[model samples]
Target: MNILVLCTGNSARSILLESILNRFGEGRVTAWSAGSKPAGQVHPQSLRLLQAKGFDTSAARSKSWDEFEGPQAPVMDAVITVCGSAASEPCPIWPGAPVRAHWGVEDPAAADEADWDVAFETAYAQLKRRADAFLALDFETLDADKLRDRMNLIGQD
Candidate 1:
């Protein structure tokens, strides 16, 4: 299954979801993340948190949602919004009419902190909780009705 994880900035929540899904999706899923209005750089605290958790952050970067709208775009099985803006913004018609859902998370980049590590840790923990629920889903065994029900439960923790 190909999954597209989206956010407004593609810097924190979306990036973390992509990494966790890729790591735990067991090769049955490939994940990508993008933004409505990208920050143009991955958030530093996100990178640090992922690194501390032993995920490779070297390839992480902010990208636009339009990258997935072209005819040549990868057909997504699911397109999940992990932030407030992408959840509320008018989204482009996804290539495959993929299962769409919102998994809104607090933006760690927006948190005011003298030590940013705490903010990143909070973000990381939230992403991990949601992603764990998502990865636990048995997509291959579900029929359409069951799948819809399961996807509806995607980010609930």
Candidate 2:
């Protein structure tokens, strides 16, 4: 399945979700990420966190959702929003009308300078937890109806 994870900036949360999904989705799912208003570059701390976790940060980038709306764009099976802004924003008309879900998470980039590392870490942990739950799903054992039902319930917290 091809999945698209979205957020407002595509720099932190969406990037994190894309990395985790790529690593843990086990070839059964191909993941991509984009933002409504991209930051134009991946956040430095997000890159560091992915690198520290042994994920390749090389391909990480902040890109606009417009990239996925063209005729050449890949058909998505699911489009999950990892931030509140993107989740609630009006979305582009995705091909195949991909299943949509909201896994809203705190935006580390929005944090004040009190303790930036802790804020990033908190966001990373939450994204990791959601990714693990998403990867653990037994899709092979369930029909499409059942699978969609289960995926919708993930990351409710």
Candidate 3:
């Protein structure tokens, strides 16, 4: 399965979720993340935390959602918005009409720099729980409606 995670900045929460999904999904899923309005660079703290957790940080970047609207882009199985603003804004017509879900997390990037570690860790834990729940489902047997319903319910926790 292919998944796309989105946020307003794409610098922290989205990046963190993308890395978590890719790392934890093993070979079963591929994940990407982008922003409605990108910050043009991945937040350093996000890179630091992900790297500390042994994730490959080379491809981590803040990019626009427009990049995924093209014909060459991967067709997503799901599109998850990880922030309130991104969840509320209009989204691009994702290829394949991926199931959409909002798993809102407080933006760690918006927190004070002194508290970045705590903020990032909190967001990471919340998102990891959701990602793990999604990964636990048997996607091959589940229909799209069932999958979408479960994904939405997972976000509620």
Candidate 4:
């Protein structure tokens, strides 16, 4: 599945979830992340945590959600919003009418610098749990409606 994860800053939660899904989803999924208002760089702690966890950091970036728009863009199967601000704002209608879900996470970037390690780890754990649940489904066999339902249920996790 092609998944797009979104957040307000795209520096922490969305980036974490995108990395988690892509890493653990194996060949079953391709995931990218963007923000409604990007912070222009990946949060340092986010990169640090991903590195400590042995995930590739080469392709990680904080980008605008607009990058997903247009005829040449990849058609997404799902779009997940990972922070309350992003979830509450109006999102552009992505191509392919992708199934949407809100799996809100507290923004780790908001924490004090000293607490970033713990904050980022906590957010990562929640996102990983939800992504794992979603990837566990026999998604290829499920119809769009069923997939959407499962995604919503997984978001609640």
lDDT against the true structure, each candidate = 0.79, 0.80, 0.86, 0.86
1-157, model 2: which lDDT tens digit per residue? Answer: 7889988778988898898889988898889999888999998888988899899988889999899887899888788887754235443333454377777777888777666688888988887887787778776567656666777688685
Model 1: number of backbone collisions: 0
Instruction: Tell me the lDDT of candidate 4.
Output: 0.86
Runs of candidate 3 exceeding 4 Å displacement: 85-96
Taking the tens digit of each residue's C-alpha lDDT, what string does model 4 give over 98-150? 58887877788888999999999999999989988988899989988888889
Worst 10 residues of 2 by lDDT: 86-95
The residue pairs in collision within model 3 are none
TM-score of 1: 0.86
Tens digits of per-residue lDDT for model 3 on 16-61?
Answer: 9999999999888899999988999999999999988899999889
- Candidate 1 lDDT by residue in tens digits, 4-45: 988887888889989998988889889999988888999888
Question: Which one wins by lDDT: 1 or 4?
Answer: 4
**Residue 75 of model 2, lDDT score:** 86
Compared to the true structure, candidate 2 yields what TM-score?
0.86
Residue 49 displacement (Å), model 1: 0.6
Residue 69 of model 4, lDDT score: 88
| Over 4 Å off, model 1 | 85-96
Candidate 3 local lDDT, residue 50 = 91
